[model samples]
Target: MSFYFNIATDKTVTADQILEALGRPEVSVDDNKMIFHIPGKSLRGACVYHSDEGYEVGVNAFTPKTDARLTRDVAAAIAWLTGASVVPEDSEDSFSPEYIADYGGEDWVAERFDEAYFLARRPDDAAEGGPLSVAGYKRTFAVTPDMFEQDAGSLEDAIRAVMQVGIDLQTLDDREDIFAASLMSFTPPAAPPQSTLRRMFGLSKPVSNVREPYTAFFIGPDVRTLTPYNETSDPFYVHLSVDQKAVFRLPADDFFAYAEAAGARAYGAQVYDITISQADHAKLMQQAEPA
Candidate 1:
């Protein structure tokens, strides 16, 4: 099987242009993606290195029926292919044995077809037995395109054709059996305040009652800003102050929306207790009642 690499980059240049940029020959570009034929006789299986946002790097595979998810196996394979350091702590070594036991086995696949194919096609000799790590190969070099034909037969020529696009290379780690590319770039838009907090903790803010002020709280790290939800509203972000004081600038009047949506038990919602460090609490108190 022939190995190919498809890079979905953050640029609009064609494959030929990428080749030209990289000063390589024998590569074809179809729109944004560039496919390359890697060197090696036996076509090893493919892997995927994906980030939270941005492009996903898929290894060339003999068939598309492969899982090729961002997992440990994929990370290891990509590290081997790219000559990047596949840190032991980034692959299967990072997974706890007890955690694996909870899920039946470490390499267990839910799909029968996947299980069978992986077992048969896995590169047995290539498998790293000890703590997995990425090793460097000398032959690998960054390349650009040249005035080469669309169809190049030589593997070296083809690899040289695969230009490095603007896809930021993040830390390469293995998740389960696939390689995960933790892309360093590609930032998504920030969500709304209530939604953001809800998603983070999977909980809702407590309602503000006349008897008790709704404690809008945030603890830990530098507090960016507590801007009002609206332009007209006062800066009511008085949950905690920089001095770690628990302050309530505004009363809590809303509740049940998030709790209802989260499907939290009645008892669970009632007994909700969020703990913070003494230092943080003091900071809030200082902010709550300024001299």
Candidate 2:
């Protein structure tokens, strides 16, 4: 899930014009794209693009469940950059009731079922090595709508829950023995049949359709990051069925340190900010400590 707003205007806006409007002299301006460095935001800058229609601005941060103020700020900045009144064209419902209803309450039993589905069908991870590898263990823990309404009295509460889940899941994945056992028990489905013509051309390969378990940390105004495990060393790392959807594997100790820091959460194991309660944070910290 991502949050972005596009405005169509009477006049075409150039990238430089947008940058000047943003009032950041250090912003990098390319042909039709401008990168705005938002302080206290992601290392990656908020991306803005100019087209004949107008300008489309997107925030680098996750969906603004807890704080949509940033998105609003970005929109206002873009409006100023374009020198035209905001004309909405294709705005996504960041917090639609339908989206919230999909959460279906905080059912750990359902989550376990979802985990079991992946374990039985998905291929093993080759990175961790051995027959019982940590290859294809994609698990997710989403902030349910019910969870949001109950635990998260406000947007801030919802964001905290999302961050807490990320820390908790990472800690759970640290158990290599448990991961190995789960992988060993499940048998991957046989690869699909290849056509005879494809076989002759050496293009016959079996493809598995199992998807990674994507934990939705934030449901409303969802945001995501896709990162490679080792870009330099393993640029073409292709072993699992769902390579693109795989989460980055980080060491448990390092992950714990990052997660424990106030307002920190993991999106694909990369640290991001979220406001969590001190009591809840401490409890997660205790669980994450060396056992």
Candidate 3:
């Protein structure tokens, strides 16, 4: 729940680079292994390090507003300096400097969003058994952002991240057409790019996945859409008209309970737990046009 972000890169981040990134901020390297600091308390306010997982840099923020703003800027700087991707702990997707600058900072509430993926839109695309049995997309316990950040290795960890955006969204007008779907599925970090997904559909790759079915609650909404696939087994594609801000991760039992409580439109199976590759992501979410 604290403000911390990881900058993931192919090249390992070293103390030497940390000094360069922050104008050589006073850093105390522990055995030349890690640097842990707190930004404004006169202690190690910022922590920068690389672990065995991959070349990385971890940054934390300040006061809620200051925290979001400052931490975001620093993280973006490091990510770009190192050719890395920033992974905000609360977010379901990785983003760049401009990406974070765009829309939906933390604490942004979703309003007028009343639609449910608890029902099956396309049964053939759903999985066999489970609450989403007839759902077009299907649900999965693996590959949610919190699963990695919280070290959710067991059912308990998954359950901890569960949050039903019920009551809050329940009273809003029915805007199923504009709201991105709740269809979620898991994809590995090295999952195939959109080109491969085009092949999966026996077609061609998409020019953009950030086009429609966006979350209307925000000024510049987060795009949300699924890749080419009529069935559940196809290589899940990029999300169109959808962008990742932050999303909740839930356990199966509780997930089903909430879905039932939400009073589904129809029953079958549908939902998601997805994480796409950087190459595919870049292909999917288009960049802003020059001003």
Candidate 4:
């Protein structure tokens, strides 16, 4: 399957210009496809030179990681050459030479760009082991009135701190079998009067009722650890009864909508969706945490 991005341009350019912009000279065309591979990368792809009406480029899937980079490179090349921007034919996302520098990894597609890019194609299939067998990834935390005495660059950064907590929890759970899903979403703000009696009694935990942003991203097939029924059990308990998956698993695309409604209502705080890759995570951590 070939993933395509459309480049809309008004500049009068020739096929030679497009090919040159591709920074490649080794190319051949047949009735099937124009084979051209980016230097030093296992990119299997073709290009459709732009007409006055704009043109498209596509790549046969090599790997999600490879394909994503190729998609961005070709699109960026075409956009740079034509002095225009590129948008995925499958999504509304538009990227110019400037934004082209944005990380276009597979994870970034779901985290920062349009999730539709991945959803349009079986993105998980691009991997060898395939995506984890999880229903999704989730993170829920109370957005304290302050970043607990830390300087949160933005509310979003504060949320990232919480998202990191969830990632750490699952990574230690099943090791490599899980914790591969990207991060997404956060809750709206919430506030409840601090209890006078609890403080007077020296109880010192922030109220859980505070605006607790909770969100789960169903990026994979399994979200929870399922316990199978076992016939052999201790005499104190039934052998057949075992714990089942309990993680919040929802494949619906309305995570943000749900966050909005829940925040506007009661109990649940507003949830804002955020999507990020492991590289993004490292970048976040490399920066000093909110002081």
Q: Can you write out model 4's per-residue Cα lDDT over 138-178, one digit (the tens) per residue?
A: 22222222221246465344434433332333223344343
Stretches of candidate 1 off by over 4 Å are: 1-11, 30-33, 38-53, 60-291
TM-score of each: 0.17, 0.31, 0.27, 0.31
Overall lDDT per candidate, in order of appearance: 0.28, 0.36, 0.35, 0.41
Question: How many residue pairs clash (N, CA or C atoms closer than 3 angstroms) in each of the candidate models, in the order given?
Answer: 37, 6, 27, 18
- What order do you get sorting by lDDT, best first? 4, 2, 3, 1
Summing lDDT over every window of 10 consecutive residues in candidate 2, give the lowest-scoring window. Answer: 214-223
Better-scoring candidate (lDDT), 1 or 2: 2
Alpha-carbon lDDT of model 3: 0.35
Worst 10 residues of 1 by lDDT: 165-174
Better of 2 and 3 by lDDT: 2
Which digits, one per residue and each the tens of the lDDT, describe model 1 over residues 222-287?
A: 332111111112222323444445323322112223224434222111111123355644544444
Per-candidate RMSD, Å: 23.4, 17.9, 21.8, 20.8
Model 4 CA lDDT for position 269: 22
Looking at model 2, the pairs that clash are 1-222, 63-221, 124-135, 124-136, 125-135, 125-136
C-alpha displacement of 107 in model 2, angstroms? 29
**Ranked candidates (TM-score, high to low):** 2, 4, 3, 1
